[model samples]
Target: MTIVVVFIIVLIPAGMVFFFHHQNKLKLRARLMREAVRNHEFTFHLPVKGLFYGEKALQEALNDLGQDINKLVAQKEVESWQKLTRVLTHEIMNVSTPIQSISQAYLEHPKVVGTSLEKGVRAINDAAGNLVTFVDSYRKLTQLQEPVISTLRLKDFLEGIMELYHNITWEIGIPADTVLDTDGSLLRQVIVNIIKNAAEAGAKNIECTWRDSALRISNDGTPIPAEVRRDIFIPFYTTKSTGTGIGLALSRQIMTMLGGLLELSEKADAGYHATFILKFEQ
Candidate 1:
């Protein structure tokens, strides 16, 4: 009877210690989140492991809410870009259309035809036409069709991509059954752009995984220059002479439109140059 009494005393304190230790971790998450919010950071997430059922559920909800808020901010930013682009495009089209028309009219006039004026007018017409075409292409940034959300099995998606780009080696580390809810076509394009950018950066091996409900892609390539990191997602910004300057920008806008966020992660995996994260609002 004395042994039983002593055992209960020991077991109860040990259990209490474990319980309190676990509780501290949970409380730490809350404190971290509060600090993060106070600093205008909404992307913080905590692992839900070792939490009680109620705390786990609350943690999951908080994680989702943080991601959703981040997504909302990104979405609003892109929407503002779209509004500005729309206004600029409208004004550009208005001015360029008249310039093109007047140049064409001048070229057709007998006074200018078969003369130096004809050559100058033709150049003007061509330049104005090119401007119109350029603006028209940028309209895609604002005119994306509503995403037809579909469930894409991540395994199959990666398999198809590897087959298509068989020249480069791939290292995939994720559950085979992992899936994503997104527009398959749109998301595939964004992912393919990332792969292409990696290859362009001289990556011979690329790694992919899912973490914290975000698709994490890393590659063994030259690191991006620090000077241009912040401008990567800005429209009409690129380092390559022949680049359209909108690949990353368009990808980011697409993600925003699809209720997600695209970010270049600060932390890179070992043996990797950079990491890009595609985070879903969910």
Candidate 2:
């Protein structure tokens, strides 16, 4: 009788403790989900360390849900942006083409000749050219396709890109011995975009280095403001007065597709550094 009573008492309290712990964990997870939603962040996984019963199963379920929601959101956003780009480009081209044609006709008209009219035509032509360039940059953003990856020599590929930026001196620290398997053209685009931005930011000297499967590009220029750095990779976010703000976003997309990451870090003393981490293929 004594033994039976003791066993019952122990089992009952033990079970209660276990149940309470599980319930608390579930509550914590629910709180995290709510917080994530409030912050406009996609929450796809439960808290890493605070998981309750069936941790693996819950994680898998949450991951699936998160991915599905993210996919749907991205699809809708892309469709909307594409439609906007098409409409805007068409409308702008329509306006620009007629102005260009009229300006040329007026400039060449023998019946009408004046210095003021000639100056007006030149101004119209210059404005049209600027608009065309702006539209072209947006077109590039919307029409990016997936890259084709292959084994490529890192040194040669980087040198080819640096050669294009002839105005700025490049200090390369890449190992000639290292080779990488990646999308050569896409990688080149990423590097070019960074270097181009650096040049715009008053960077006279640019340094490119590769170490431990990571590529770091540093430039001696004005440091990017902390507020702008947070959203530098976001679509339509630009620090430049005339920037289209899609280059960094596209580069990040390409890197993500290639199982890599693009990150920015402020230099301790001066300038800023952007790093691309390429995962080695298994």
Candidate 3:
């Protein structure tokens, strides 16, 4: 009877205290997480351990949620840019076409041929023609063909591009059996554009590296300055003397459409190489 009295007097109260302490700990953890999310502190990573299994599961779920949110944000941004480009190109073409047609007609009119204004009209006509070409290029930029995805051997693709520049020295690092899923024709255009740029830049050696679902094409030319690098992927931004400046921009857009990524990384070592990185989906 005395032992039973002790059990009710001591162990019962201790058990209640322990249960309340655990509940308080879990409540504190949940409150902290709510605060972090409200403050937009997405970098928060939960500890791997806790007093209960539910806490560990919550940590994993939070980690995955962060990753998913990041991907969704990136995808939305790309879609927004593409939509803007389409609208801009469409409106520009509509305005430029009429000007081009009118200028040409004025230049060819028999009565205007011998007038003092003839030379001025001819100049206007030439400018309008240039505008037409620029508009057409923008049209192409905004309306890229949907890629037909297929499995392709990387080495074979690189070899074909190399053949086009026989005089340019190139070292291909991809193995013969290395393969990836991509649209051969579209990807070929992207790679060709990069190689062409390298050749035009007077690069002596071009190195291609492939690993872990990424391909890096590096050229031993001039190292792009930090300021210029920021604008390289922007449409109509180019440092070249005579270039449309949309090649890299279009290529990046295409890669995004294919659920991949394309970017430029510079090497500032002795070689001063400019590298274009292409990342494919796993």
Candidate 4:
């Protein structure tokens, strides 16, 4: 009886010590997570090492939460920029239309005709005309019509695009019977825009197929730079000197309007510099 009592006393104190240590560890992890989220570090990760099975589950959940937060933050940023673009484009259109008209009148005036002022007026006219045209391109981004969804035949759809671009070698691996319910016209526009951008980037080979429950188009050309990835969807952000930078942003907006997603795959397969994924609503 005496020996049993002694054993119980020692074991009880040891168990309590471990319990407190484990509790403190969990508390620390939670505190750190809150701090990370507060600082907008949504990519933070916590390892599930030396944890109780139940605690390991909690850790896994927390890790997934961080990834979810990161996605939500990205979506919000895109939405905020899209809203700002709409407002800015509206204002620009309102102002540039009058400027373009006034410049045209100045160029046609007899007093300015065939003189140095004509050259200057012509410059203003051209500038205003180009500005109006550029703003017109952005109108598609803000004024997207409601999608009329239809059953899209994958093979036929891609074949049409393939026939149009002969310079770039195309390898399409999607099954023949694979059908998608989407807005066919809008979807076509998005794919065409992406292909044109890739062609301009010097892509010699382009491949499109289905992967991970989505359509993935990958190209062997200039990879998107890391610096450009973050702002790739922002309106008017372009790498090319003549690029209006409306393609991807407009594509993303179209997909969003269609209850789908269009995104750049960060880690592309070997031999491919860039990959884009299109996931439709299920």
Candidate 5:
């Protein structure tokens, strides 16, 4: 009876310890998993044998989700590019077809060496030349050079850029020692386009800020209307009388090529009506 009593006492304490240890192991594994997914380490490796059944099941689900997300993103990008090409083709043919017909008619016309028609034909030729130049500029969208990336100090870059727009007031909120890995020249072009548009829209104040590797540029200009917002990112889409419609589109393409994103945010702060955000990959 004494031996049985002793064994019971020993087994109870050992069982409690075992229970607590197993619980803690599960807790630790769950914590690590949450951290990995939050940090975007979706490809993190885990031993198949050491984990409990639940952990193994979770790992398999995550792997499947990651693959599905990648496939969807790739498919969407291809569709977007295809739509952009169709718009470009339409724009090109519209100009080229008329130019070809007009020039050919001028050549075949029996209106001898010089007359009033000669002046009209010369004007048409000059206009066609200008349209060709415009199309050539648009082609640069597809020909963007790969970025030469480097670590850049944000405050200094903004301060220098601020020098270019002396007429507009600046409200800079970038944190000190904030740095980013990006292509300086290419990023500058993107910023320039945004800032230029803000100034053109009659914005008296522009705010530049950053958080969590995302840069925000807010302006005191009128907010873009809801209907126009959806089409703003489409290549060759614009509302301004003189707008080429390529600036924002080119900026977005550059950001995509750098594995980042450029987008317009609907939210606004007091006194500012429009905002453009650029998010970078970690």
Candidate 6:
């Protein structure tokens, strides 16, 4: 009986020690996982204590944690974008309204129909037209609606877009059989904004091509400065004297909403190239 009692005592303590050690290991693993998430590494790890709770329960916990982190990051990004858009829209509209009203008034004045007044009216018209255009562009950036998707022939759609900028010289290289599923209006706007930027940059030769689900537009104009290129998609960031700087921003937002992406690259020669990748729906 004494031997049995001693054996029981030894076994009990050993079991307790093992239990605590296992728990300590689990705690350490959980800590490591949290650290990895904080560092933006999304690698998944099995919970050390998972065996106690069952694999399904442990997986659920990890999934919930991951979702929470993603939601926080996404919320922060959206908040920042909203703030920037609001500030830009407010500043642009302030300038646009006065210019439009004054221009209309000058043009409508009976006494100002002829003489130097006509010249003044014309000048005001030009300024107001530019302001109106800027305001329109800014609105596009700040107020994006959910895209309406449809299947479209890539060649036909691109050809139509090219027609709008027919005055500008262009060289297009795209497969005639390429087809894409996307929002037609939004895609057109993206094309127009990029083409307009190329024209404004004094592009004498604009080249467009499509491959690997991406459409690339290259313009042989002055290269975009590295510093400016970084912030090109930012709302109200512009290099032009008359630019409202919302065109590229709007285009980026549209593409993002459509589950696509827009990127800018520089050529070794001269000028900039903009690429838009349309992700295929799974």
Top-TM-score structure, candidate number: 1
lDDT of 1 by residue, 1-282 (tens): 999999999999999999989878877887999998886567777888777899889989998798778777777778887898889899999999999999988888999999878878899999999999889978878888889988888878987887867878999898989988889888887889899998888989989998867889899888998778867877777889878776788899988877778988756888898999988755
As for candidate 6, its clashing pairs are none
Model 2, 30-102: lDDT tens digits are: 7877786675445335545655458767776886676456445544554565677778988998898788778
The candidate with the higher TM-score, 5 or 6, is 5
lDDT of each: 0.85, 0.70, 0.77, 0.84, 0.77, 0.70
Q: Tell me, what's the RMSD of every candidate?
A: 4.6, 6.4, 8.4, 5.5, 9.3, 10.5
Error of 5 at 204 (Å): 0.8
Q: What is the lDDT of candidate 3?
A: 0.77
Better of 1 and 5 by lDDT: 1
Model 4 has an lDDT value of 0.84
Candidate 5 pairs with clashing backbones: none
User: Candidate 5 has what TM-score?
Assistant: 0.66
Candidate 3 collision pairs:
none
lDDT of 6 by residue, 126-222 (tens): 8878776766666665577788989898878877887877677777677778788898998888888888887887767777777545677777666
The stretch of ten residues in a row with the least summed lDDT in candidate 2 is 268-277
Give the alpha carbon lDDT tens digit for every residue of 1-282 in model 5: 999999999999999998898779878767886786685334334445666688688767766565445434533553486466657856886887689578757856788327777777767767776776677677667678899989989989988999999999998898879998889999998899999988888888999889756799999986789878757767778889998888888788787777777777656655798888887876
> Over 4 Å off in model 4, which ranges?
1-75
Q: Residue 255 in model 4: shift from native, Å? A: 1.3
Arranged by TM-score with the best first, the candidates are 1, 4, 3, 5, 2, 6
Candidate topping lDDT: 1
Candidate 3 residue 95 C-alpha distance from true site, Å: 2.1
Q: What is the lDDT of candidate 6?
A: 0.70
